[model samples]
Target: MAIAARALGPSPYGPPEGGLRNAADLIVRDAVAYAGRCDPRVSVSGEVVTGGISAVLIGESRRAFAVVLGDRGLGGFTGLLVGSVAVQVTAHARCPVLIARGTARENGPVVVGVDGSPHSDRAVAFAAEEAVLRKTDLRAVHAWTGPASTRAGDMLPLVYDPELVGEDESRLLSEATAGLTERHPDLLVAHRVVRGRAARTLIGQSHGAQLVVVGARGRGGFTGLLLGSVSQALLHHAECPVAVVRAAEV
Candidate 1:
């Protein structure tokens, strides 16, 4: 089903497009090639009205995976926009949403942010799969700090050297990366442990990344049309496109 886009609003999925051009076609093609056959694809084009939009979109694409062509204007007034259109689509869309700025490439590792939450494991699995597909490394990162982690650090070798913060994080990173290596024996996987917010650390470390993978929600399972704040923050802020994996429910 294709929508002429007579409108655009809180639709259930990404929009279908028409009147395509070479640049858009190439981008769509490259992203598809990078994502491969298992994933869905949708090309989104519309006249963004800075702070507002037409409030309705037609067509539901194959599986609602959208690549929105955003202009420079939306970046400035992003504050006025709640969580950003990209974020909204990534969070609410039925399937995964790939919001890209430039063409896709299979270079950087699929970096996933893990917080020891069940959702984090799902994200790690998602990242590992991406690494397998791209023939690249998987960087699974977990950041922990503050008082709650003190005793755990004392007992955990990775976090044992509290005074040696660098060493502490190294151990933690190793622990997280171990699972990835076992699952995808052919994959080259790595991990990092930092001391800060999950979203900020991932964004900072993945500056030149190919893709930043994350979970739609965590154990807390926060509310609203969007997922957790970290997922939302990453969608708006990450330098590279993001792949958010929501935990599969029984």
Candidate 2:
């Protein structure tokens, strides 16, 4: 089933009640028509909810498997308004949140973030399933820094070698995706280890991707922080759709 919703709020200027209703009706009509024609077997519903957009959408997402949102702005500034809503929902919703960027390529690979965290494990599992559903290749990316850089900026940068760090990161990435490809025998998987800021690297890699999947919280994310910086960055800047996957319910 597909649900198309418009969260309404009081507007001081512009349309009156009747005009607003007409506009809402037109929006829903177009949405339903497009949705219906997309897949005949899929059932679609249109709704207009009165409240803050974020809260209304988050509430509706509780019973949904995933909440899909569109990137509001154009190419360079994609998700200007939608980023806030996407982050809010992804941080608090009980289910996964999918932020679809306007610049996404429908036929590209699915990129997934990996850092060996439990949250990332869930992300990988979800990405694997998504790759199967989309019938695309899955690219697992792990970003890591050298020990010297890993330390706070206050500390002097040590001239350390990345040989050891790279080896360990490779091992961790392999361990994280060990059984995933086996589980989905027909799925093709690729792994990469990059050294840099996690968010920037992921955003750059997302340029040609159809979708980017990341954990709601990662290794560096504190428990109190609602969402990790990497995931938050992807919501705002990824070229393709981004999926924020939370840890599985116990």
Candidate 3:
């Protein structure tokens, strides 16, 4: 489905005869045409509505499998990689929100961040389905940092065994993706546990990835925060499309 939202306001000359509607129609028409070219067998529909674009899209997202949006919209500054509308919709959308950015490799694997959080679990599930649909492999990544690494200038150096930390993180990755192969018998799956920040690690992985999927909010996020740092970072800087999936109850 193609949707275009136009906000109409009072004008001294009154509404310009069919101007908003015509522009909206053209936008949706072009979108439908492009979709038709992408897959001739798929049925396409269009809708032109009058309201705030983000609100309209968010409302429609309730029934959508996913809400796909460009990283930046028409109103943003040229230098802004992610627009306000994209961020708002991504945060509030009921289903997965896929933000299209740099050109996605047609054959790259679907990469997902796995942190053993419920939100991360949902993201893994979403990525698994996407990988199966694309007939590509799924790569689940879990990134971690030493306890003291995140802190600035400490009085005492915190000591921990790197080997044990690595082992624990590897186990976490395994547990996070334990049943993926059983659920998707034909889907290929790979696991990676790296010692680094989640966002940076996932961004590096995205370089050759067709899609990067991450939970809207990770384990470290505040309850009131709709979008987490890792998800936001990918949305702004990933090399391909980024899909942010939110847990059903969260």
Candidate 4:
């Protein structure tokens, strides 16, 4: 389905009239035409609504399997990597939100961030399905940081073994992806546990990835926050398409 939203203005006399409606019609028409060319077997539909674009899209997202938007929209500054609409929709959408960005590499694997959160578990499942559909491997990555005291200059150095920390992180990754191979018998899955920040690690992995999948909110996210920092970072900096999956309600 192709949907377009137009911002309408108040008029004392009557409904405001101009080329905005025409522009919306043309956008929907072109989109429908393109979808038809891409796949004639699938039924295609279009709708043109009048409201804030982000709000309209978020309302429509309830029934959508995934809301796909471009990295940058028409209204944002040319230099902005991600537009305001994309960010807003991704944060509040009911389902997965995919931000279409750089060219997707045909042979790249599906990369997912695994942080042992319920949200991350959902992301892992989503990535596993995507990898199977794409006939590609799934790479689950878990990024961790050392103890906070180690980073503080004024604090006494804590005696903690780096090797033990690495092992624990690896175990976390294994647990997060425990049943993936069993669920997808034919899928190839790889695991990586890196000692770094989650956002930076995932962004680096995105360089040659077809898609990077992450939970909308991770372990560190507060209950009131819809989007987490890691997801936001990837939305702005990932080199490939990024899929932010919102965990289902308990």
Candidate 5:
């Protein structure tokens, strides 16, 4: 994890960056001892946001979870840039991003977004493992726009289109749910399929959720809309924590 901080002024508000190195080292050391995990590496790198500490973990195993710690209390001047660094990193990073507030609780349930992306498949694999390790129930949520589509003022099966779109959405949710079940049979899994905008749907669902996971980038680039817009939105404003997963091996 890349944790970077600088001593802008002094103590009380944002503690000096001096102790962060030792603190991060201690945490990693203890993790290796108790968790028996071995990334055998850690870092405290610099970023745009001054004073606040940001952690970036690199070279961790495919199954290893990366915790991006964002310290609370940003100076008014840097508040605007707070999300800038976190957002860019969250959007681009290959691993799951954990934005930890000073008040974050440990050993919490992990919430990941599944929108049928290949990236989502990878996320499911990762989150399921974490849940098993933490001994927590895994909530795999699928958000569908029953009525929201490209055309704003149009309906299919015009004769009696009693939410034909809704039926399709239900199928989408069912497929996503069933797909995960087949892939992760041993996982203690529970799923939710809700109707709303994708981002809004998941963000709202994540209120009581400990961690929110989504794809880093989706298939919505050019020819094929592969990624979910909702996934992008969740990274912007998730109540608890957010993790962006990439479907492909990057």
Candidate 6:
């Protein structure tokens, strides 16, 4: 395990000089000691840097299993939970980024967002592994918006049918989660097809979840884009820790 902290500025309002460094060292020692109490094989290290928090986190993510951030922090920045810094790091982190929400619980399902893209598929796999690790259930959620599109007055003449679209969305959700039960026979899985905006649906699910998993980029996003709107929204608004899984390269 690696514990890192960034010293942003020199002012008292900012981190005191060497404060982050000392915090980093303490975190490393405490983490190692805690892990040792749990199991003697765990080793940990410390890394403290003087730079922008988002930049340091992004850099650390290249080699870390996951980069975890608090839902809110003491930076005096207004956007704490769903803020710009969280958005930036979650969008661009190379590895999976986990935004810690509530207390890390030992129970409750691992919730994942699915959109029939390869990106979401990766999220499913990650969520599966997480479910196995947590010894919990996995809940796959998919959201569609026939009603919202109609409200937006963007409905096409023959192509826009609410019932058919909803069915298709359900089918896509099933297809995306297919074979997971067979692969992980011990893992229990459930799925829901919701009618609303994707972000709102996922955020609602987060209330009952221990962790919410999503793809860094989803089907609705451009290929070159670093993060989808839904992922960005979850990073800020989720009531539970949100995992943004990067898509595998072709």
Q: Estimate each model's TM-score.
A: 0.60, 0.82, 0.89, 0.87, 0.59, 0.79
lDDT of 6 by residue, 1-250 (tens): 9967544345566555545456666776786677578777666555556677899999999998998776666564774556566778887888898887764456989999998778899999999999998999999999987632312246546557789788888888899999998989999989899998899999899986889999987766456788889998887778888899998582
How do the residues 7-125 of candidate 5 rate in per-residue lDDT, one tens digit apiece? 43445565564355555655656645644433335443332222323333332313455646462323435535235556555554555766653222355567767765567667777
Best by TM-score: 3
Q: Over the stretch 152-229, how does candidate 4's per-residue lDDT look in tens digits?
A: 244634677889878878888899999888999999999998889999999999989999999998877457888999
lDDT of residue 171 for candidate 5: 63
* TM-score-best of 2 and 3: 3
Q: Arrange candidates by TM-score, descending.
A: 3, 4, 2, 6, 1, 5
Question: In model 1, which regions exceed 4 Å deviation?
Answer: 1-84, 102-106, 147-178, 220-225
Which run of 10 residues does model 2 get worst, by summed lDDT? 148-157
Q: List clashing residue pairs in candidate 3.
A: none
Task: Kindly report which residue stretches of model 3 are placed more than 4 angstroms away from their true locations once superposed.
Answer: 1-18, 147-157
Model 6 spans > 4 angstroms off: 1-42, 103-105, 147-159
For model 3, what is the C-alpha lDDT against the true structure?
0.88
Cα displacement (Å) at residue 50, model 4: 1.8
Clashes in each model (backbone N, CA, C under 3 Å)? 9, 0, 0, 0, 14, 1
Model 1, residue 75: displacement in angstroms? 11
Clashes by residue pair, model 4: none
Each candidate: RMSD to true structure?
9.5, 6.3, 5.2, 5.7, 8.1, 6.3
lDDT tens digits, residue span 95-194, model 1: 4555564324457777888765555677777778878978887777877663224322254344355557656556655654566667788997776777
Kindly state the number of residue pairs that clash in model 4.
0
In model 2, the runs with Cα more than 4 Å from the true position are 1-19, 73-83, 148-160
